[model samples]
Target: MNGLHLIAELHDCKCAPRLLRSVDALRELCLTICAAPGLTPVGQVFHQFGSAKAPAGATGAVILAESHLAVHTWPELNAVTLDLYVCNFSQDNSVAARSACARLIDAFIPERVEQREIVRGSCPK
Candidate 1:
């Protein structure tokens, strides 16, 4: 399947503390972004990590009909990494993928961003 994949590395995010450490908050943000781009959400899973000796962080993934969106946050470092992939099997979903990525970036309010786009599963003519 032909698809567009976006990967982003965020540094120095200034979002609220809860957003960076809470699994529920991250999950909600992912779901909202998915809806904003009209991506179908089949299911989702989010996990929180850290202990008293360490700083808390979160990891989440939303399973979409077209593909999936995944995110990981490091509160101690004020950093985040995001991945969004959409298969264009039936139609072009590049726009939707970009929109979702933009929404995520807006929410994080990162001071520095490193993003890349990759075209996957292309067939030779």
Candidate 2:
């Protein structure tokens, strides 16, 4: 399944209050963004690390029919990293992947973003 993979590092992000702290909020955002790209989400799992006294951050992955999307947020540093990958097994999903990635970046509102796109799996000869 040839695909496109998008990776991004966001610095000085000004995300919504719930986005950085609440697992529910982040899950919703993932689902919403996935839908925007017409990706079918099979399931998802998110975990919040650290103690109640001093909350750390959240990390999660959304399993898609095409591939998957993963994200991690560092509230203390106001930073985030995201991964969105979609396979072209059935159709070309590169555009959808880019659309989803763009929406996520917009939500984060990062002052500086380091991003990259990689083509995964070679085309059939």
Candidate 3:
């Protein structure tokens, strides 16, 4: 796998307890992740839908040089879904992606987490 894409399903998150209801928090997180070394954010957008009182959640994506990072949060459930994708490009950016991802996960401090890594691009058959 030359490139790496990480997906994490966070359960019972604590860092952004109220962030699930605030699109602001979600956007901030995305921006922070994109600021990591080797990442270049091209564009970003956030969405809020659901109950007016409680707020459904926040969903958005940040386009990066290697690829992109997206996040979705559910305040009511104290759960969040996160994705970090970085291509090897000229060199290996996988380590950078993982380091950046660790920061995001640290922020959530989820009680339970389901994470996976997928290899992208072509290498050896």
Candidate 4:
């Protein structure tokens, strides 16, 4: 195993107050992360919830050759929660995971964050 998975919870994102309420931005972010180095995207699915209602949010998932990346947004609270998971079948894909995570984080520009990087299927027990 030689893969990496990163989980991040972004709080108080400025753009979440304006842009992330729509599913388009969420889908775009997922695609961008999928295109990161050393990763291959096989498919993707995104759903927009309450877009025309009193409150709004977006949920998206990108299927990759290695594994998947997912994101959920709560625009009313100005927050976004993300998960990036990649598996290494032929070679290590840790660096690519990190690079992609950074790009997503930069897009949100959160005022506070809770982040973790985990070795997925890469730890030998």
Candidate 5:
């Protein structure tokens, strides 16, 4: 199956602190982002690293029909990592994947970003 994998490292985020440290906030934002790009989310999972009294970063994954989206945050470092992969079996999903990835990057409002697009499983030019 031909697929696209989007990876990004975000640094010095300027977004709301809750988005970086709150589990619920991150989960909601992720799910919403997926849908806007016409990506079908089949299932999801999220976790908070620290306690409510002293909240830390969160991690989550949204399982999609085409593939999945994984996100990890580090409030202490003001950083985030995002990975989204979508396989094009019956139809091409590359456009949607890129859209979703860009939206997520924007949401974080990172001052500096390192991003890459990898075509997997023998892609055509």
Candidate 6:
């Protein structure tokens, strides 16, 4: 399956603290980004790490028709990691994937961002 995978590490995120700790907020953001870039969301799951009063962070995955988007947040460290992949089986989805990834990074507004791009299954079969 030819695809594009985007990885990003957000360090010292400057967004609202609530965004870092709230599962609802994270889930909503992930889903919304998918839509903006025209990615199909078939299903989703998000989980909060700790109690509300002393929350840790959140982790979630949005399974997409093209591929998937996964996010892990560390509120205590003001950090986040994002993974987005889109398979180009029927059509090239790289642009959409990049757009979605960029939206996520923009939302976090981190002081520093570490990013990588991996080309998957591109070799001729």
- Model 3 bad stretches (over 4 Å): 51-53
Error of 6 at 18 (Å): 1.0
lDDT of 3 at 63: 83
lDDT per residue (tens digit) for residues 54-125 in model 2 = 657888899999999999999888888999999998789999999999999999899999999999999855
User: Quick one: best lDDT, which candidate?
Assistant: 5
Collision pairs in model 3: none
Quote the positional error of residue 16 for candidate 4 in Å.
5.9
Q: Compared with the true structure, what per-residue lDDT tens digits does model 1 show for residues 1-125? A: 89999999999999998889888799999999999878999999999898535539999999999999999999999999999999998888999999999989989999999999999998534
Q: Which model is ahead, 1 or 2, in terms of lDDT? A: 1
Give each model's whole-structure lDDT: 0.93, 0.89, 0.83, 0.82, 0.96, 0.94
Q: For each candidate, what TM-score against the reference? A: 0.93, 0.93, 0.88, 0.88, 0.97, 0.96
Estimate the overall C-alpha local distance difference test score of candidate 5.
Answer: 0.96
- Supply the global lDDT for candidate 6: 0.94
Query: What is candidate 1's CA lDDT for residue 81?
Result: 98
For residues 6-86, could you state the per-residue lDDT of candidate 4 as single tens digits? 999999997645457778777876786668576788899988888466438888898988788999988878899999988
Ranked candidates (lDDT, high to low): 5, 6, 1, 2, 3, 4
Angstrom error at residue 22, model 2? 1.5
- Per-residue lDDT tens digits for candidate 5, residues 1-125, read 78999999999999999999999999999999999989999999999999998889999999999999999999998999999999998789999999999999999999999999999998655
Give the poorly placed runs of model 4, Cα more than 4 Å off: 16-18, 53-55, 122-125
Whichever of 2 and 3 has more TM-score, that candidate is 2
Q: What are the clashing pairs of model 1?
A: none
Best by TM-score: 5
